[model samples]
Target: MNKTLLGSIYLALASSIWGGMYVVVKIVVSVIPPLELVWMRYLVAMVSLLVVSFITRQKWRIHKRDLLIIIAIGIIGNTISIVAQETGTMLSSAQMGAIITSSTPAFMVIFARLILQERLTLKKGFSICLATIGVLLIVGADQVDLSSKLGGISLLVAALTWALMSVLVKRVPSEYSQIMVTTYSILVALIVLTPFVLPRLQAINISQLSHPAIWGGLLYLGIVSTAGGFLLWNRGLQMLNASSGGLFFFFQPVVGTLLGWLILGENIGLTFWTGSIFILIGVILVIKEKK
Candidate 1:
């Protein structure tokens, strides 16, 4: 199989998994604060990944050289970007979150140029713009408040840092398994989040967390979205460069909308279908160009 094709599949699947996360995140965050949700998310993911690593009989040793890069990946993407994303979602509307953070591919292109010196071909550039427009169309500026400046800024922060972290994944040596890399990085984030989240735990009604939805949401986020999604994303980036691979992130909202329509009986009109076409064309352009 072509590496680019496989990479594209991995990237698309990762984002699609996260698309269903919209409803779950809202439910979990209502019961758990932003930071604490992040902490617990990583905790669930770390434990899940570590168990997989052990079963796979993977080498656990990291060369001193790559340790810092992995740590940076964890802290930047897993910690900061997520913290900002959840916080921004809490402060702002989910529609706002989707529209703003979808800028990640553009930022990834910029960072790839700066950090990796990857050239942005004309095809790549146009596809990004088209997909971005598709995103805007799908999640139109309805009931959004620009007055929520803080939330907007936090989401922008999330986009920028996540982009940087995605680009940085290219720096880690390919000899290491992405599963291991993802697990270790998540562990790093878990350690960083523990202190802050611990103190705030007592204030929340602990009994509320025992609900099946809360526990189920956190587990899905940890095992499927975090562990599985991050590993697939990281592995895909290994096969494709950051600039091209990041385009697949656009699928998140498309999948979210699709799932909403299918599962939640959310209405999907012509605009939604039209936007889906744009996103598909954008993805196809990248895949063909990379090939």
Candidate 2:
């Protein structure tokens, strides 16, 4: 199969897995504290990826020159980003989290142009505007009272952190395999989450383990969302042009919105549809301009 076909398939699968992840997270968070859930999810993901790394005979060693960079990527890309995202979900609705996170592609474009000197086109500029409008419509329909302060701040932090991670990933040298980078980055995330794990462990009642929702959610997150989704995404990016690979992200919010309705029985109002239309338009415009 051609690289474009492979990339498209992989990206679609990644988005679907990610969409389902929101439902799983909602289920698990009911039983476990958000911090604990985050720690366990990454712990499982780390172990799974480590095993894959070993099986594939991927090198674990990094040059001294790249060690700090890898660590930074781990902290910012894996650790901080996940923390922000999960915490944001806990504080706000999953719909809000998904919509805000969709803005990452726009941020990625801006960061590429400013930091990497990549050319930006008017089509992409228009798409970014449309996406912003879509996000606003979604936020408005939700009737989010940012008067709470903390919830609003958390969502914004999640958006910014995810954007930062995207830019950081682009800065990494092509010589480093995406799998190796992802594995190392996840390992660091495990380390960063360690402190929270023990405290949560002490608080958990043994009875909670017997809850089907808890284990099922964790399994879904570890196997499907984190491991499978990420592996496919890395493969897709390897096969496709960077811009094309980035455009695939545009599907995430749409998938997320559908999943929200199917799983959570969340009401999708007119604003939701209108906002999605704008977001889609914006994404198409941006990619066309980039081309």
Candidate 3:
């Protein structure tokens, strides 16, 4: 298949994996706290990536000049954004969290313009606007609670930082393969989070850790969701223009909402389907623009 086709497929699968991850996360969090889960997930991701690097024969060396950018990506993207997202979800309802997190693509377009100097043409602008509205509809803006101000703010922070990280990934030297970048950045993030996660580790249920379900969830989140999902996402972003790639992120909420209904028994309404149509239109516009 062509690179574009492959990239699109990879991105779609990545989003689906992440969407399904919410169900797994919901189960795991009942046994493990969010902060501890973040550390555990990344730790598994880091080890899994190392195995991938070995198999792929990826270079591990980083240029002296590139070291700082790598570190920043690790801290901002992995550590801060994830912790904030988890905190936000804990503070707010599922609907509100999903809607706020869906706002990432909008911020991504804005950051791409400012940081990467990517031109925001009329088509791109319209696409972003359409997708943002679709996201709000998909999650039902009417369901949002204004009372959870702190949670709302935290989710916004998660969205912005994640956007910044995506743009920054493009700025990294091509000398480092996406695998190398992911591995090293995750390593850095693991180191930074260790101090905090270490304290929380004490509370973990050692007997529960041995359960197949718990380990299964950890492996899925760490290896599949973190390692596989991110690799596909970053690779797709590398292949497509940032503004256009941002549009594909709309797939996250679509898959997420569908999974919520099928797996969690959440109700789906007319607004959700209407929103899905708009999101699909936005996705089509970007794909056509790319062609």
Q: Which one is best on TM-score?
A: 1
Candidate 3 segments exceeding 4 Å error = none
Error of 2 at 50 (Å): 2.7
Quote each prediction's TM-score: 0.97, 0.84, 0.94
lDDT, residue 87, candidate 2: 72
- For residues 1-291, could you state the per-residue lDDT of candidate 1 as single tens digits? 988999999999999998888778888999998998898888888888888988998888899999999999989999999999888988887778889889999999999999999998999999999999899889886757898899999999999999999999999998999988998888889889888888898988889988999999999988998999999999999999899999999998898888888988988888888998999999999888834
Candidate 2 vs candidate 3: the TM-score winner is 3
Ten-residue segment with the worst summed lDDT in candidate 1? 139-148
Candidate 2, overall lDDT? Answer: 0.69
The true-versus-predicted C-alpha distance at residue 117 of model 1, in Å, is 0.4
lDDT of 1: 0.90
Model 3 poorest 10 in a row by lDDT: 282-291
- In terms of TM-score, which candidate is stronger, 1 or 2? 1
Per-residue lDDT of model 2, residues 1-291, tens digit only: 755666667866787687677667777877777777777877788788877878888866677887776787678766776677777777777556655676676666766667667666655566666777776676463555455456556766766665556556656676877778887877887888787688668787778878888897898787778778877766665554444455556566667777778877977789878887886676455334422
All models, RMSD in angstroms: 1.2, 3.0, 1.7
Cα TM-score of candidate 2: 0.84
Model 2 segments more than 4 A misplaced: 1-9, 135-142, 234-247, 269-278, 281-291
**Candidate 3 C-alpha lDDT tens digits along 165-244:** 88888888877798998888888889998988898898998889888878899999999989998888888888777777
Best by lDDT: 1
